[model samples]
Target: PEGSSLQACDEAARKLTEMILKEDGVASISTYVGESSPRFVLVIDPVQPRNNYAQLVVVAKDLKSRKNLEKKIKVLVEEQLPNVQSYSRSIPLGPPTPYPVMIRVSAPTDALAKEYAGKLKQVMLENKNVTMVRYDWMEKAPAVRVELDDDKLRQMGLTRKTVASALYAEISGYSISQYYEGDQAIDIVFRLEPKDHQSISDLGTMSIPTAKGAVQLNQVAYLSYENEDGMIWRRNLLPTITVNAGIADGVTGNDVTNQIMEASKEMRNKLPAGVTIEIGGPSEKSEDSLRSLLGPVPAMLVIMLILLMTMLKDVRKVIIVVCTAPLGIVGVILGLFLFNTPLGIMAEIGALALIGTIIRNSTVLVDQIDQHLAQGMPRLKAVTESVIVRFRPIMLTALTTVLGLIPMFPSDFWRGLAIAISCGLTVATLITLIVMPVIYCLIFNVGNEEK
Candidate 1:
């Protein structure tokens, strides 16, 4: 309710955690006092949090439970702490980040960015799908600000450097000098001894050097615990405020992003000319990954077209063979849907491989028909023979391939790939055996020559 300080933050976290743990499906609750990580496996470069930032991480037993648990938590929080601001989140699709929904507010100044970031944070919290609203850049940490008085330093017959070093030596110790115990040299470290350094208020009583004697630090320097947001974050040489939050269960990152975009659309018209808002975190990354995958598709299709035209030497024949590949894609999509799998990178790779297999089957049938035509067989007879002859091999190839990949079908990591390949091949094989010959005849005007 008040300013952010460590003690205040911890007390708030415990209270929030107490409220969240009461939910039926909640399995565990992790409370953060000023932006510390819940995970213990590893920590990269870390930043010291300044304000009374806190979080209540509520994890439920399962998906069905998680949604209900979160909804209950929201209701409890709303009923009890309506004055407090909070953000929520659902399961994220991409890799973990600082926040699932990070709204980056870039403006001319830290204050300006922070202002917009606060506004955006409220906008996000308004959406039921969003949660855990936080912005560290705007947090004014409780800290002592000490500035040396120039006149006081000169009157005390002390230099600013000496007084500054003395202050540092009192609190955070530094090397006085070094000593040697044999060939190895050891630098001597010094600071205010245990009793004198016990409290932050001791600084008022701490002494600094003067020409005549020692003077208390308060005589030479101004001291007070000023609330200041010390950390200044810059991106692209412009100040930025990152407002982050989590998503609610039964919701997706895309859904949250879409809601945010809709909610913030009016903000765009109201925003200053130089100011900008960028939605980031997992949602943005997911879109970028998807766009990257789709970006190369047109080029790949062009290359495929050129290769097919070069190899077949006939536009009509190449078109017929290439068209059979999509027969497999229908199965690919169907299999993914049935298995409740996302059409991710693994599925795309599987689809690419599936296309090759489909084209191979179509090529085999078409080649067989061409051979028959070269021998002067009737066009319809050629088509019948090609279908009959190629059916066994196409069926056998697909069946064997599907059987081989069936072992991988159950694994989550490989499930999409397995389903795409196995199902696509099976469907495409039938298309190649039963449909390709007809397409071939229609394309080349071969089967109806006599008719």
Candidate 2:
């Protein structure tokens, strides 16, 4: 609803709690006003500068996923409120934002922004991965339209300020004076008693002074209700509406983003001139972060491979070592799957680190095999001896690395990262030790050539 108030937000939150009050794992729903969030504003003051915004902070019983419960709460709120025809729910996704998808629709005017945002939101919902969708650029609420007649004002010898002051004093109220008691100070407010200004008709009875003396405000101005922007939002001085959504469980953020882009061609035809859409929020952030990290990946690989080649002087051995490095992912994939952990950026970084350690260990084992080969030992014996000689050292190195990350598994924040490195290194180390000899034998035909 456009022109919604702090009170209206509270009412919605109140009803949301009423609907989910009996649901299991619901602790409480705490609501506050004017912070641009529907639930849980993380600001310092209890209240900030007045805006038509607020949030409903919901606490659940321990570490429970209350996504379904939140969906039910939205359905109830929309059903009860006539103006609130649509509703969506999201919890704290923690730091950054809770919404899985946030896209910005910008246009020269509010109407265009609203139209584009609505269309984009609809397209996003078509993708099954997206569970909930809402846009901040619209308002369904009706505003109190107060218009003063200019001719009547001139005839009555009155100015706009006097009538505005009277209306402000009568309805919005005003601070008359302040009293200082010791070190404390308090405002003494004065205004028409609640009974006198409870309704529009009563407010019209307010008297404003003119050159000809006092006259009723209603006689000069007309008061009515009209639909308007229920909420106002802007970005970089351009009219923008942010469309956000709650994603379904097991759905990758990238998957939903790909759907939105694929649907964009058709969606663009519906948009008016001067309206444009920009991908944002988690989807945008993920793309950017991955791009930044991956930019140097090829160069890093080339440099590492070059260094390994220089040390071994054998391209086949270098290729064998690199192939064994990625065998660590077997453990990484299994660990996350067993723990039900989502693969995020942290996990990607951990994988990179694990690969680096694997290569270093492989290089050391390869050096031992080369040393024995230089002494004219049989290729088969040299490969067998190398494995036995490197096993204890490689195991101890992998053991320390895994032990260091042991505490991270129990942590919510670091678990994804720790699981990737710890499990990947453990599995890769064992595989590399056992498989390197076979890789060396196959690549060089070491035993056959020696015979």
Candidate 3:
């Protein structure tokens, strides 16, 4: 807590202010807390009034470098303000380099906002994962002040209203004329060149032609900078500043998140007592969805088995019929692989459908064979007879199912499901027609001969 980067940030601000004051021509330098960085306002005495501009604010890579550069002020702060705290050198739980890190510093007043921003900017520059950081929330743009002199305007014989009208007319043009050429229509308007209004000085120097003579705008009015008004828009209702870092090409989101957590932990230990850090993104959503889907798999398998038993009745018959379920599954998996379709909810639903249809086909054939055996036919004859009799219906049903699914294969959403089902039904039907009857006959013979 004593050596927190925040403390370093505070020290950096004091140092930066001193550095600004030390520079020649600087009339005044002030630092204020900002939502993102410390806001520095520098007033410079103009050597030439015409070329005078606001002070330049230079941001460092991190707080340490800023503090290092402003060493003179550090000594001054220690001498003058003994109670002022300097941030720790290390972070307790700081993330590794190239991981995104976000920090929130709340100020009770605007003065505090400006003060903290200066410190935050310094700390961010020192941290490695902090590649790009910004704080538009606290950084106010200088206001453009156009001071109109009544005496100068009276001398020019131009009223304030006319001056205001001319300024508006030159900056924002009004549409004047419209003309048509055959089917095309075009509009034309009058306005000054774009560069004429690019800066405050350009606006000050603009000449307006009136009845008396051309009057230079600067002669009537002076321009100065002012802070922009209104609070900045924020995402998720937090005066949040984000520091984005680019992960290396091979790094995964999880890896980057882990690295950031590690670094943040280190940073946290060094943080002043009250500071806290939180990390979140798309990775959280993925983890939740994966856990929800994973928990139901066993229940789904048991349900499918129950359904197989209910439809087939006999356990042996159910086994023979359910064996085709895997053949269908193999077909679906192969279809997914061949088409390069990643298995998703729709594909899984397609697999479930394939299971039902393939089992039905196998069940129908085996049931018929059992019926023939129950009617007193020999086991071998019953199987041969069942296959010969069921072949046409099985082939017909499979062909119809394949034809129905053919139209769905071209659609991206349905194609995966369609291809899986179509291939599964085709392969499973073939396996069921050949292997299922053989299994049925063997089971019946084994049981009957033993009895």
Candidate 4:
């Protein structure tokens, strides 16, 4: 179906439109024939125009309506239109992926690329978590290949260009000259009547005009029917095929991608020379985003260390504060588990912010202890008094921060960040109030110091 005519694709789209209109919550549908819709949203990457392709942009009433329509439309298309390939999904809130799982196979030639693409598709289909697995390039369509006989052409006093022009005029129209009327110019074309060149057999029998007179095409050439790729995808001019799939409910795309990767170890080992396979889609996008976000982390940590040293002026206290920073991981893990949130980029950001919060809390407590020691208080009293004095302020700071994040919990984008900060800060506060003081006393030999 990849090489289906525009009429066929249009009919399929019309039928699907009828089915979709009957569903609830569908407000309107804009249909684009012979191509994908124009880019209206940044997340949507439209495909190029092809005779066999049509796209529909469906609108729903609200968020709840959109969610319901997404599931219903997917089922409707899969069940009622088995012959047609279709993909239905809601516009993503973040980076867009054509499918949840996309595996790309690239090779030096199209045949080898398609061959391994099929193998990769089979591997994906074997996994229970993968569904609707398919590749971008569909089955080859029937085509005609013409091979001109050079010796016969020369004997007939014909050049390859003349023969090619004659064939083109017979099979499809060839513009000869222009005719103007009423300020408009129209090309005068020549082509055989539909009945005369409708079939491949007719093509071989078409006449070509030469200096000698008209000669049958088969007299100087060969015409054969063969299967050729309907569409070819390439990356850097090397043939590439992408096998895409959807994941089952309740499973993340990364989880299924990892599973498939593990299962295909043997397949990868057997891959032909010059062929390479890799995973793409959501996982790849997320990784790229995270890498960019984490690029400045080491610099930030170094800057924070410098600030802490300048403020506290002691390596012992700086070590105590820095060591306490990672203790918030316990809360991050526990919070995500308790709230059923994923440790996504937003949550990672919150964890990073939590580090600054933890350091601030610990620095205040340590600086308090330093102040008391400077005032001639015994080491034991300094450590004990620091914990007692910082307890109320630390707890209040964490409480207010957690309360402020309550509004963000309802948002899909900010929920992870909110949970990470709220939960990590709560735990980090305890480390500052309790753990930091204990570590400080231990490092300074408070118990053995002369009282």
* lDDT scores of the candidates, listed in order: 0.76, 0.77, 0.60, 0.86
Name model 2 segments beyond 4 Å from true: 1-61, 64-94, 148-166, 178-187, 193-205, 218-224, 252-254, 268-273, 291-331, 378-381, 403-407, 434-451
lDDT of 2 by residue, 1-451 (tens): 4455667766765665676676777887766565643323542123233445555666777654466666666666667665653434443333465466778898988878887787787788788888778775565666577899999999998888878887788777899899999999998888878788657787677788876678888899998867776557777877888887767877766667767878887777766677878888777877788789889999999999888888889899898889888888898998888888877777878887887898888888889988998998888999899899989988998999899999989876688899999889988888888887888888989868878
Give the top-scoring candidate (TM-score): 4
List the candidate 4 regions with Cα displacement exceeding 4 Å: 165-197, 205-209, 212-216, 448-451
Q: Is candidate 1 or candidate 2 better by lDDT?
A: 2
| Reference-based lDDT, residue 292, model 2 | 91
**TM-score-best of 3 and 4:** 4
TM-score attained by model 1: 0.71
Ranking by TM-score: 4, 2, 1, 3
lDDT pick, better of 3 and 4: 4
TM-score of each: 0.71, 0.76, 0.38, 0.89
Of the candidates numbered 1 and 4, which has the greater TM-score value? 4
Query: Candidate 1's error at 408, in angstroms?
Result: 3.0
Candidate 2 to truth, TM: 0.76
Q: List candidate 1 stretches off by more than 4 Å.
A: 1-96, 175-189, 193-202, 249-251, 287-303, 428-442, 445-451
lDDT of 1 by residue, 1-451 (tens): 4354467667666777887776677888777677755454342223355445666666789878987876676677688767556655454333656666777889998778888887888788899886567774676656787888999788888998897788788777898798999999898888878678555568778988777989998887878777876677888989988877777655656567678878999986799967999877766877787688778888877898888778778888888888888888888888888877767667877987887778877777778878898999888898899888878877988899999999998775688789999987877787667778778778778746857
lDDT (tens digit, per residue) of candidate 4 on 1-451? 7668788889889988999899889899999989888879988867878888888899998889888988887888779877788888777767867888988899999889988888888889999998789787858888888999999999999999998877777767888899999999999988778888768789888888988789988888889989888778888788889888998877878788889888888999998888999888888887888999899999999999999999888899889999899988889989999998877888988988888888888888888888898999988888888889888988998899899999999898899999999999898788667788778768887777755
